[model samples]
Target: MSTNSWDPWNYRSGSDFGTGHDLAGLSVQATDGHIGKVDEATYETGGSYLVVDTGPWIFGKKVLLPAAVVRSVDVEKKDIYVDLTKDQIKSSPKFEEGGTWSDTTHRDEVGTYYGQYDKGL
Candidate 1:
């Protein structure tokens, strides 16, 4: 993982994905398989993230994925790929609907969970 795991929370550099495009409704693929669709996306410099609506995969659960995990974006196919497994996303801190990103506590919790790969978790 990158030393600053949360840095550059946009689509990976040189992936040719447009930052201004609407990602909501696009399918999101995990390293293993399809996980959900992008319910929301942000391109904020260091706080970018994706709110994925898991539909029936996790009983309509939604997961917040840090943009750092985004490996690529396929606008043609309308798919977003992330460098993470379903289990990894499943194990992340539970995200409540209608939560705001301004909540630093929750964001910190999320950052901590995703950053654990560096510690060999």
Candidate 2:
């Protein structure tokens, strides 16, 4: 498990949780909080900046976690978590069957909805 010093709900504005790291192959947790191993991550290509595969979390529901929405990462524990609640993730944008990432679509749907989350820092 990631052993980084992560404070509870540290994702609010002007908090240290916003400063995360590369998201490739990081562990993913489900809404019920079950640990789902990350299978893939799309970045810097095809407009997919932060596309990650939770395997089944996005089955018709592509829970796109914007760069800004991220809360923090525990490199030691090999985990990268977000700030959103279980319901939020479940209600986020939904992708196609066996689909990939798209920045334009995300910007229009997820980014526009989340706002300031697509601005890569």
Candidate 3:
């Protein structure tokens, strides 16, 4: 673990996991089915998250998903599996693509939305 609280992207020490850059563009699937592809990712000391672009599936909506919900990553298939459903993600806190996301309020709202799931923080 890192002492830097603001470090966006958490990786276990001595692990072989790839960084956020490696996850971008990978398809993200919910428990039910495919939701979208990862537009970007942020890994904080608290946890990690993925910004997913829903494309035509959801009228080009973009959403933020907690890394805790992520069950697995298939590098060969370019896929990421999460334990949430499409509706759960659709109803989560809206994610704006600017500095507002860095706000503690926004982060808290997001955290609250997924509070039922393990944060893995």
Candidate 4:
């Protein structure tokens, strides 16, 4: 007998209603209004993140958002709510293509940027 257990329902642990794999293509909504659609997502032991493509709104700029900032996922509405504003996300650390997501330096930079918002600084 095989000892490996399979959980189709729990394919993604800690996921709210949908997994990171299912997050792509979903619209990302900031506190004020819709920001963009998810271009991609990264799921790791440390954390998850989404790359949102701000189509036309900001000249097609993209941004990275930590999963911690995700407030909720509405499958029916096909939307992901984040506890931030358009200006906040627009001003956040820009996500560079090919950048290492696991790098401590990068993580610290991003964490610090978002931390400032939490402190209202």
Candidate 5:
């Protein structure tokens, strides 16, 4: 995805998938099937994301999903939908626990990985 994909609306206060509700613990669904649940989420204007806990799906690993990938949010159902498939999420860049996402290098690594799918790179 382009950097503009990270511009915030995907998870901003007044955007399509964004709302004034806590997203923690909400189930996350991929295009193909269920992936996990939101372990953490950020609402920063330019840097938003969902940190999903794959709970046994990936040996209890967590993956960071950029807000841009979020396709929709179902507040009533407590679910977040993304445009990617399980395999795609599974093979994306690994998220090291306790690592800060504010680090540009790490963000770039992740952005690049996801970008490839968007750009068909």
Candidate 6:
């Protein structure tokens, strides 16, 4: 499903940006949310992302996501959904949080990880 059809598109809106918010319950699965995390941040251009906190293994890391990887959102419970799997998410190369994604090299990995899944959405 497109972000527009999601129940709570507030995050999809621009009213709130660069502010801390809660997305803990959103069903974030890759490959249609079978394995992603919560809907973390929606970019300024209407693109949403999943913050894959690397947990204790790789420390707390995060990543960016576009609608291409997103499948839907649960508005009734204020949740976000996706169409991915855990192995796929876990297998992807990890990154450090916050200050990481700024390099061209770092940005390139996004596509590398996403691979054909990007589909240029």
Quick one: best lDDT, which candidate?
1
Off by over 4 Å in 1: 1-10, 118-121
Question: Per model, how many backbone clashes are there?
Answer: 0, 2, 3, 0, 1, 18
Q: State, as a TM-score between 0 and 1, how close model 2 is to the true structure.
A: 0.55
Q: Give the poorly placed runs of model 2, Cα more than 4 Å off.
A: 1-22, 29-48, 56-62, 97-100, 116-121
Query: Scored by CA lDDT, what does every candidate get?
Result: 0.78, 0.49, 0.70, 0.69, 0.76, 0.46
Q: Deviation in angstroms for 95 in model 3? A: 2.8
Candidate 6: which stretches are off by over 4 Å?
A: 1-25, 31-39, 46-48, 54-63, 118-121
Put the candidates in TM-score order, highest first: 1, 5, 3, 4, 2, 6
> What is candidate 1's lDDT per residue for 1-121, written digit by digit as tens?
6554445345557555677788899999987999999998887777788889999999988888877677788888999987788999888898665778546778778877877653221
Which wins on TM-score, candidate 1 or candidate 6? 1
Q: Candidate 3, 106: how far from true, in Å?
A: 1.5
The top-ranked prediction according to TM-score is: 1
Kindly indicate the candidate among 4 and 6 with the higher lDDT: 4
lDDT by residue for model 2 (7-63), tens: 221133442333335557777553246334444444332233345555555453335
- lDDT (tens digit, per residue) of candidate 3 on 1-121: 2233322224434233466448899999888999999987776667677779999987898877755566678888889887678888888887666755456766677766765544343
* Model 3 spans > 4 angstroms off: 1-16, 96-99, 119-121
Q: Using TM-score as the measure, name the better of candidate 1 and candidate 3.
A: 1
Tens digit per residue, CA lDDT, model 6, 1-121: 3323332212333222233555554545445333435435544343344555434433444555543454455555555555456556666655654554444465456545655443322
Q: Ten residues in a row with the worst lDDT in model 6?
A: 7-16
Better of 2 and 3 by lDDT: 3
